[model samples]
Target: MSGKPKLYYFYGRGSMESIRWLLAAAGVEFEEEILETREQYEELLRDGALMFQQVPMVEIDGMKLSQTKAILQYIAAKYNLYGKDLKERALIDMYVGGTTDLMEIIMSYPFIQPEQKEGHLNTILLKAKNRYFPVYEKILRDHGEKYLVGNRFTWADVQLLEAILMVEEKCADILTNFPLLKVFQTRISDIPRIKAFLQPGSQRKPVPDEKYVQTVRTVLQMY
Candidate 1:
């Protein structure tokens, strides 16, 4: 609140990635306390910083917050990105909820076994094309609006753009059939704040590589 919000997570993108995107879109500069070892995670628990004993905890507005959705909602509201009215907020919530479903699958991708990677990738593409992408595409088509709700750029748009990039990382042609979403993605990415976040040397994290996966496993003792 007073100073920049500090994020607690691994160096890799996981649940914290959306928080990063939201903060960036809000034009908020934040700090990070990356966890590299199991001890660092335990210390947060020992210090009672993590209410649910989890990473992705954010120190913001004089409170230590955990739970991905709660933190995101707070940031969205604080930055006036939620929406103008309750109905618009509800629409944004529904759209964001759908995007989160797809993002959650991609979030777990790094931990997947080598042999299962292809199957998982297929699932991601399938869901993106058949289920997720179609919904947003239809929203834009029906509303003929630049954004998903109230024709205003809100948290839904931010989450949608993040989800689009996550899916594109799997297959570049993932949105070929979803023409409106293609335009939507371009429009959202071109926003000044969002564009800065997409540029090189920004806080945007790349797809998780072997080292990132191993580091996360080691920190969480997932082996």
Candidate 2:
């Protein structure tokens, strides 16, 4: 009800995760609004004031902005959550873009039959992870465990953790074989800020059940 910025998110959905994590990391307060049904979304859409072409839009002083990555960059810039230097911001963009690629792959599965998901895993997920994941591992390895950039927490780190956890929860075996990614993920999850965000009550909406998690995992791990 307050006039502060508001974020509209779906429970357990990808659109909201990174932004939610970033918001928590910045200690930037927000109003979390849930859209639990298509009807609700439709109603909002019908109103014609919602920003871009998706959920997880942020309303700042009643102005709406949409698209997950755009929202993220906006908030990061506004709150000084990105980093101090040009190189660090570039790295943040790289990792965040990588996450977007991963999400695209996962979203593609919705159109495939349950059985076909495995095929995607074998062809797409396998190739992508093998090629791209090591890049991320190397980043973490080079950063020396202080943070994604300059020994300071940035939106990039929050984005990485959320994307990694989404994979861990939905596709457990996807990156389990990567030592650095696994270790980095564990380390990120252990951060006090991130740990508190992962707590049950902090959730703005109910998480997907274990069965869905396993189902996603089973299909994604086919590679």
Best by TM-score: 1
The global C-alpha lDDT for each of the candidates, from Candidate 1 onward, is 0.93, 0.69
Instruction: Please write out the lDDT profile of model 1 over residues 1-223, one tens digit for every residue.
Output: 4499999999989999999999999999999998999999999989999998888999998999999999999999999999999998899889999999999999888889989999999999999999999999998999898999887889999999999999998899998899999999999999999999999999999889998999898988888
lDDT of 1: 0.93
lDDT of 2 by residue, 1-223 (tens): 5876787755455567667777777766778776655566667788874665457678875578887778888889888977887888997898788877776665555456678867875655564467667777787787667567777777777777766665554557778667887877787788887788888888533445544444434433322
User: Looking at model 2, how many pairs of residues clash?
Assistant: 0
Question: What number of clashing residue pairs does each candidate have, in the order they appear?
Answer: 1, 0
TM-score of each model, paired residue for residue: 0.98, 0.78
| True-structure RMSD for candidate 2 | 5.8
